[model samples]
Target: MSTPHDRHLLVVGAGLAGLRAVEGARAAGWAGRITIVGDEPHAPYDRPPLSKAVLAADEPPPVPALRSEEVLETLQVRHLPGVRAEALDTERRMVTTTSGELGYDALIIATGSAATTVPELSGVRGVHVLRRYDDALAVREAMARSREVVIVGAGFIGSEIASAARARGIGVTIVEASERPLERAVGPAAAVRLMQLHADAGVRLLTATTVSGVRSTDVGVDKVELSTGETLAADAVVLGIGARPATAWLRDSGVELDARSGGVLCDSRLATSAPGVWAAGDIACVDGVRSEHWTAAGEQGRVAGANAAGADAGGATEVFAAVPFAWSSWHGHRIQVVGETTAAGEEDHGDGFVLYRRRGAAVGAVGINSPGPMARLRRALTAQTNP
Candidate 1:
């Protein structure tokens, strides 16, 4: 192992993945000088709560810090915030940022993704997208003053926003382009239940619909134009259409990227094509698949950091292979999913049963609600060595 004297690790992006990368490097016994660069001004914070707790909260909840102040103090990292990485110079082992250039012995990228928005709604007032704390605050402010809210997507984010809007007695109408909401993620069985849950909660869900355009008044957006030729009055419009990986800065960086996801192409170990470079989080597509789940990002970061640190010290390194898992909350029910439930699977039990979703010979995924089933499947999945 190299002595603590001749090492410097630089992490780009300050999300969960980037934060974990620094922590993982430390845990792997690296005494290098660690530096974290992020475009955002704030420190690392949890994002999942932005769509749920922040929207329906009676009192504005405290900022959700993923790495607490106490935790940050322990990490002992040098943070350069509000500085966007402009380019990467792999040959020189330097990153060109908006502020200046940063050099590194090893690098980890976890730039995450950007919230997708409609170009047609560009420059229109009251059109919002939620992907950051500031976005959540803006949406919360808009929701507080709005009556009719048009959510232009039916994915988990849109559905969660609808639930929160309904909780505040605001009229919510979700316009989904797919034939059924969450058709790609959960298939028809679970999708139907989620649909019913939304209907029961007094939220209007429109499927197989697209927003052709928006009609805005001088003050703000007042209506949403639909491809179905029906225009609905809206006090505000929230775009939850989706997101794209934040890979624009790496376009000319000579790093291999997946055209489909626009994410950094990495091997099973989360190492990119460039030597001494690794990627994690939504920015990384490992083994031809990019996982958008929070847990997967953290795991990938851990592996990337460990490998980067170990390689610098000529020590041991580990591969990352965490089972994909995600959880969603809506209308007071907890929805937990493991692996790829959409894959062809055999049902071990009837509908609403847990510990099912057996694909080929292995249990590919499990969807559960209650504590018992979720606990069992979580433990089983966690113990597995591979995805």
Candidate 2:
């Protein structure tokens, strides 16, 4: 391996994680030539806003850029937009792209993940999955014309879209296989109140419902069939069934990935099993901790990039030890959560109180709608994590 000062760094993915990785590498004293490749033609932009502000507006908000073009130019990072990485040649220290092969001394994989879609919805018009900028645009356009929108799954993405659709005077029906929304994350108690928020907004929530298949015609989807023998008439269908890590290209690259989540497995320092490679963001499972939050992605990207640079520079390495934090916006309320919200013991403080998830003697997680307490709890959690 070449010294960090003499190495060529290549970062995959043009999202927030990839952009932050370049910044983090430079901050760690890496002056080597850096190249970034992205399948999307557009530059790095904020994705969280896609399902929120952009989808809710009549005129979709302009793409929210994470970093300005001038900043990238100032950083001297070469960006190859609209390019897909076909394969990784670990032995040759080269990356095979749609254009050609490029050699690299160090590689950072932050390709992120793709929104999950069902096979039954494939080739079906008006059935959309929101992941890229274009996906949100299409969904927003559909909402503008449709009176009823059927959204599969009641997770974060699904709930957000429901809110967006309702904002545009479109009736929304959210279908979830689980008994409650965010059952895996926030538990049943808090989920009840969360579900109430949607109901209060005139959105319909169908719990314990399974989508059998989608009924579509030549132009677009007409109705969605449910396992409960109920069919919902819809002009548009949005699949919020979650996402899987984008790691198919790394299949033959010899990088270790967790079988369950299909996320790239990394050590304490976010270093992958492959010698010259590191990973972060939704694509990474660091020491068994896999988080899909936007904040977690950016932080992991910083740690991974800095550690990769430090390793090459033969300097002090940084371990990724940040506590997990994620927040969701619904009905104009900020739902903030810290640590693992799915812990065994849960305490419901009742109306207007934070739900605390506990394991043994320690508090494992905290979820609240109020920003004040959430901020204080976040500080406490940060101290606990650091201490």
Predicted structure with the largest TM-score when compared to the true one: 2
Which 10-residue window in model 2 sums to the lowest lDDT?
Answer: 359-368
lDDT tens per residue, model 1, 252-278: 787889988899999988889999999
Q: List model 2 lDDT by residue over 273-294, tens digit each.
A: 9997999899999888788889
| TM-score of every prediction relative to native | 0.94, 0.96
Off by over 4 Å in 2: 1-6, 357-368
| Clash pairs, model 2 backbone | 4-312
Give the Cα-based TM-score of candidate 2 against the true structure.
0.96
Q: Which residue runs of candidate 1 sit more than 4 Å off their true CA positions?
A: 1-3, 59-61, 346-351, 354-362, 365-368
Model 1 clashes, total count: 0
